[model samples]
Every structure is written in structure tokens, then in C-alpha cells.
Target: MPVRSPLYLLERFDPGVVQLDRELRVIAMNSLARRLLPVEDKQPFEKMVLSFHPERSVAKVKFLLDQAECPVSNPPPMTMIINIPERVLLIKVSKLSDLRGDTTGYTLIFYDITELVSGELPVQPMTPESLSIEKPAPAKRQLHKIPTVSQNRIVLVDVETVTYIRSEGHYTWVSTAQGSSFCNLNISDLAERLDGASFLRIHRSYLANLDFAEQILRDEGRVSLKLRGETTPLPVARTSVSRLLEQLGIGEVDAQRT
Candidate 1:
């Protein structure tokens, strides 16, 4: 087949295809490439398709292509993003060879895979009935009711009731001035429901209410938090010291004292 006919065929092809040379410079591109690429030049034959993907630079592409030339039964496909001003592209790369069996470079075919990953693709619209059909009815959130100090009533207490919360296996122990109570709630769930300003997670296993904290202590270079009515100091990890101080309205001045 003539070169012109092959070029014409490439133009009509659906997927965007760019042919590169040994130096990874674009030698030719199909009509689909013209539509996909942001290049202003009408003639796609001589245009060097520079590495559009920010993460996948020209150096990285060349390195991968070189690796692909090795004798392997099967090579894993490389997924890369093509950064265009108008849209983001998810690209799949395949090594290309010349007619003389020399490793010329690579061919990249890309499509917009952003919507699929981001869950933006509209399936069936969700209705109240449709949402409830697959699962049991969700229990109503009882935020208005305040639980008394007595343990007689079963109460759904807010995170604010507790001065400090500690994790025990699957359950969390919420401690207050009156007493401590166990709840079958994870630290993550409590963190989401808690008031950000009042409560702060100082450790992976513990969350403390800043309002109830009397003082924050640094014991021998290790940090610990002193909660109201609590005899034992709550362990504060070094990683959480900065965030914990910020939440308590204590800045550099307070940090230096501790």
C-alpha cells in the first residue's frame, strides 16, 4: 500500500493515533489525533507531538519504551494522563516498530476516562423509593433528645457530651464528668459527627473535647493532654501536637511554654 493511502486510512480511524520516531518525536498523526490534540497546525505529518501528560514526561516515555523492547512474553500496559487545556485524557501506550523490524518508538491512544472514575456518568436517577428498595429503613437520627446522667434510658448521644473518647477494639468509650459509657461507634464516625471547634482527635485511638481540656502538658519531651475530671493524662502523639494546639486556640506562645 502507498504511504498516502495509509495516511488517509489513519485519518479515518476512530481512536487517536500518533506515530513517533526513534527520538520519540511525532512523525505522523491520524485525523482522530487532530480532533483530540490542541495543536493549531492543519498538517499533522511533521508535527512533533510533545509529551502532553504532566506526570508522564518525554524522558519517562523514552525510558518505558526502551524497557518494552526487552524480550518478554507479555508487557503490562501503561496508563497515563494527557493534560490538554480543554479536557483531561487517559492514555494507553503501545510500543511501535518500523517495517525493517527496528524499535522506532511508541504509539499512544487516549480517551476521556475521567467520568468513569469520578462517578460523574449518569446512570438511573436516584429517587427516595429507589434508594430504600435495596436496604432496610435507616434509623432516624435522635439529635434533639439529651441523655441524663442515669443509665436507665437508651440514648443516642452527640459527641459533645463526652470530654474524651477512647477506642476499645470495635467500640469507643465516651467519658464525661458524670461517668463513662461504651458505644458501638468507630472513631472515624465520631470524628465526622463531632463539632470541629469543640472536639479534636489527638491520637488514632483517642478524641478529646477542647472545651473540657484544663491544660495540655509536655511530659519529658513527650506530649499529653489533661482533661477535666480525668486523673490520668491522655497520651498525645508528636504528629498531632501542632493540630491539637491550633484547635485549643494556643499558638506559638503556648507551644513554647509546654
Candidate 2:
């Protein structure tokens, strides 16, 4: 994996606004947009909006722009959530027009929602094709590939590569070595769907894969498990600690001795 850019540390809550001419050329941008984007690294003026984005994101941005050209009067803004490096952005595009109804310009607005996602995980950019899976009727089957949402696109992650899963209200955030993505399935539903032999409910909000287990950390009587490729240790509930250790082939006595 490549080193994460320090720019990911910038405040994510602030809104970034950019203005584009009818030709889709960058006209202006707010201070926040300059900081949030690569405006300094790349020339902004006379550059097409697509040029400002990474090659992988260009198609999605173009789609958003295309969707904004609604024939009806007072069309709603086109919205999408996209991943860039270590950040997740919620973007909206609104079209502008002259008095005669001729297209004038556009306003592109975005918010960084990285905190709502997995902390410290670089969000992997997903393609539109990845998001186009047909929804089939629910059935009881072991999950080999889990579907996750990133940039309004669905990404299929292989189950073996997953490190952990965290509950977010009814939805779940699936974590892997690359990054985390939002999964529509609830934790309980996922627990039931996933292979019991591979995943364990270590806590009410956490499901851990024992294959990634690196070490069992005990601090002040509380137990936490450090997973491979993950920086933070997952809290192991008091009740689940022994089970987790046993699953790792570590007896309680052996764990205490270590």
C-alpha cells in the first residue's frame, strides 16, 4: 500500500464550493475548496472540472454533470458520494441559467464525511460498474463476497480479506487491508449471513475475523485484540475474551502468563 497523504488530516466538516462556466471550465472556488482539493497542485482556471479529479473519478464526475442537465425548470441538484484517497466526499451539483433559460454556469458543492466512515482507512475508489449488481431475493447462504458502498458505487469485497466489521446504527462498515466501505446490511444480519467459523461477535458493535488476529492486548483488566494491518485494537467484551483467546488457540492461563 502507498503512504497516505497528510492532506487527509484536514478538517472534513467544512463545505467546499467550486464554480464552473457553461463550458465546464473552472471559474472560481472558495477557500475551503482550495484546501480540500488539489487546486494548488493543478492549475484551476480554464481547466475542465474533470481535469481536477483523479482519472478514476473523472467518469463519475462527468455522470454527475450530465445528470445535472435536467430539461425541466427548477431541477433538483444531482448528488453523489465519492471516495478520494483517504477521504469520502458527498457532492452535489446545481445548474445555473440566464433569464432566457440558456445555460449559464454551475455550482459544485461537496462535504467531507470521512469521519462517518472508517477512521484512518483510505477509502478505495469504486467504479460505476461495481455498483450495478442486481438485487436478488434474500436467501440463507454463506457470504464469500460482501457488497459495500463507496462513491455511490457498490464494491464487492472478498470475505477472506476482511479484517473487521463495525456497526453503524442499522448499517455496518466493513473494514479490510485497503480501507473501509459502507455496507447496507445490519450487524446482526451480517453475523447470521457470514461464516461462523471465520467471523466472531467479539462485542455488540464489532465482528472480528480471527485470521487477522495478531495479539491479545490486556490493559487494566480490559481486553482488546490487535488485528494485522490495523492500527487500533478492537475492544473485546469481557464475556467474549476467553472465547476469542480459545479461538486463537491461546488458553486463558497462557494468555495471562504472556
Quick one: best TM-score, which candidate? 2
Instruction: Give each prediction's root-mean-square deviation over alpha carbons.
Output: 19.4, 15.7
Report the error of model 1 at residue 64, Å.
52
Please give, for residues 158-234, the per-residue lDDT of candidate 2 as tens digits. 88999999998756899998899887556776787678877999999999998888888889999898999999999
Worst 10 residues of 1 by lDDT: 141-150
Cα error, candidate 1, residue 8 (Å): 76
TM-score of each: 0.43, 0.48
Q: What does the lDDT read for residue 65 in candidate 2? A: 95
lDDT of 1: 0.57
Local accuracy of candidate 1 as per-residue lDDT tens digits, 1-258: 333432243234346677777666778776656555544533435544454433324443444456556564344445443223323344556665557666667777765422222233332222335333346644322212122222322233444557888877544677877677755345654565456777788999998888888878876788888988889889998899999888777895777686
Which residue pairs in candidate 1 collide?
none
Report how far residue 5 has shifted in candidate 1, in Å: 80
lDDT of 2 at 55: 66
